[model samples]
Target: MKKTILGLWLLACLSLNALAENIYPISREMGSGTRSAFVDIFEIYKSVNNKKIDAIAQKIEITNSTGIMLTSVANSKNSIGYISLGALNNSIKPISINGVIPSVENITNKSYTIFRNFNVVTKLSNPLIEDFLAYTVSLEAKPIIQKAGYISVSKGNFKSKNPRGKLIIAGSSSVTPLMEKLKESYVKINPNADIEISQSDSTIGVNSVIEGIADIGMVSREVKESELKKGVKPQVLAIDGLAIIVNHQNPITNLTKEQVRKIFLGEITTWEQIQ
Candidate 1:
């Protein structure tokens, strides 16, 4: 009789634990450049043939901003998501994919494949613009970028000219945090400079520069061929990796790319399926 009572109590505890856990999948909104690069790199398209098909059906929480995505995943113990490595923090855990971890060493050696370029779009260049661009790839800026969790571009030979003017940089939310750091450092040397930043999607940033709405547009991915025809020039800024993150409490250490693909496709709905 005691054994039967103990078994019933244990079963009840297990049931309660199960009830407390729920898996949440989060994604960025439709127009984000980060979303575009992520889907393209993962081959998340529905069609196997040379034709278009419906997108994969999955119940996901769509966030308009990277900040919200970070917050949502940080609060849920069973949630999984992705964010730029620059935005990574200890609030959540990043997982290994395909037997490799996301790190500067991996990225520097080209072992990490899920990276995109930081780009700036401009309609016309002037001395002031050229100076600011040079500062971005200078030796001094490298450590600032590295400290912010991003890889710096090659230190170029361009010399810094004192640029003093109001510079408006607008675009990719993923790039905004890193840009803010750059802005802080830039203004310190050029106290006469006024730098303003805005976070719309990347496409808007490109368009803003082309239309003269902003002095420079920040883009997380390479400038699309379509946008190039609009007479906008692209300057490569930095290289950033995308980190696949999950709640720190999740015990799963590594995920194969195929497993991640299936999970996002809604084919693997339960954590038990992977276990």
Candidate 2:
């Protein structure tokens, strides 16, 4: 009787441990939709493996926030997080799965599976927004996004007459380089157009656009459905990849989507366990 009770208790403990696993977002990462898709893929992989996976970290929470800030938080040990390639800094490292680190070469060629298109959002009613949108769609701004760490969606020459009006653009710092590139090109064509670019998180950028404070909003993530209800249309300009990097010293290479989720959720906590 005693032995049977002990056995039952052990089994129950194991079951509870298995049930503790879950998927959640890492704060500061770009592309919430991409994060959602990654979670879905990780869950599917775990189901096939027939083993309960551990959480990499709890859902990332932030106070003073940006995608880069959230990414910095998530980049800590045993944590799997994603951020735009342009946002990478010395503090964080990208993860390698199957020996492939997400990069421009891999993403552009479609060798990297995790990627999404970013947008240049604007209000339909604002003429300045319309002109900026037109310029973004023109051939001049296409290569600029690519040069700034994103992949362009279209190719065409811009023919708009320079509007001599002041315009404001706000978005993630990850979008800064792309924005700068676009500004340079736009200025070349319409030398008199006054453009100002501001850096902030995706949420803040969207908010500014909603408040009518900015003519154009650039975001590394898709506009939320809620934002759509407010009259902001996310016009996709280019595709970008969120890279998961690691310290060069870490020997482990190649992590599956499931493993990555586990690492971030604080489930599997060591390099050896990963092996």
Candidate 3:
């Protein structure tokens, strides 16, 4: 215990000495719904000639997908990033924000404030697509979604009408994990239905549906009004907390909303500063 304390003290001192050098903050690339929701939730913007422009610090590392975000944090020291709580695993440590752990109960009860909608988009839905979508919003999918650490919001019963067809679902990597589980359960009951998912960013998911390439698009954030204008309908499947994660080696656990906002905005640029 003494040695561990001494080591941490020494490290903190080193971080203090270089207040703006080593700490790395990671975020998703632009056009990502997860990034959009994060910026909105945290109010990460600035007025430029009266227009509110996104003002994420230039130094923040950008990853393309939730998988990349997890891997980047796991491999890098003094790194911080965020991903869907449903996707969290043992590779990284998720820290509490404002003393509230990102859990299903907290998200469902509305205590954990950092959360976003898990939306599924569709354009000119076919009968097969509608049937599968019906299954997604029914009570049967509730346990599967909840089991994946997301807050299931649907309460309905679905009886598959023996629909048979092939369909594609593409979109936000953040929503893919839960969607995959839901797909597995749906396919078992409706054996004639075939579904393939292509993993990518949220923007691509919306566009793909608009272009008539995919029957369904999974997006981590709510479907934008701009997207709605394109004649696509969005179905919110569940609610998910955006889990702030760090390398497992990091010791500090909790951060205030203000602290996180500052860190990503380049105001708090070091581990010691956050400490």
Which regions of candidate 3 deviate over 4 angstroms? 1-21, 48-51
Model 2 lDDT tens row, 9-62: 997775455334332334343333344334444542234376543322444543
Model 1 regions lying over 4 Å from their true place: 1-22, 47-58, 157-159
* TM-score of each predicted structure versus truth: 0.87, 0.71, 0.92
Steric collisions counted per model: 0, 22, 0
TM-score of 3: 0.92
CA displacement after TM-score superposition, residue 61 of candidate 2 (Å): 8.0
Ranking by TM-score: 3, 1, 2
Best model per TM-score: 3
lDDT of each: 0.81, 0.63, 0.88
Q: Which of candidates 1 and 3 is the stronger one according to lDDT?
A: 3
lDDT of 3: 0.88
Residue 153 local lDDT, model 2: 72
What 10-residue stretch in candidate 2 is worst by lDDT?
Answer: 21-30
lDDT of 3 by residue, 1-275 (tens): 99999999999776556544467999999978889888888888898898667789987889998999999999986899999999899999999999999898888788899999999999886789889988988998888988898887876998998689899999999988888898899999999998999999899999999999988988877787889999999998888899999988776689998888898899987777766
Query: How do these models rank on lDDT, best leading?
Result: 3, 1, 2
Worst 10 residues of 1 by lDDT: 51-60
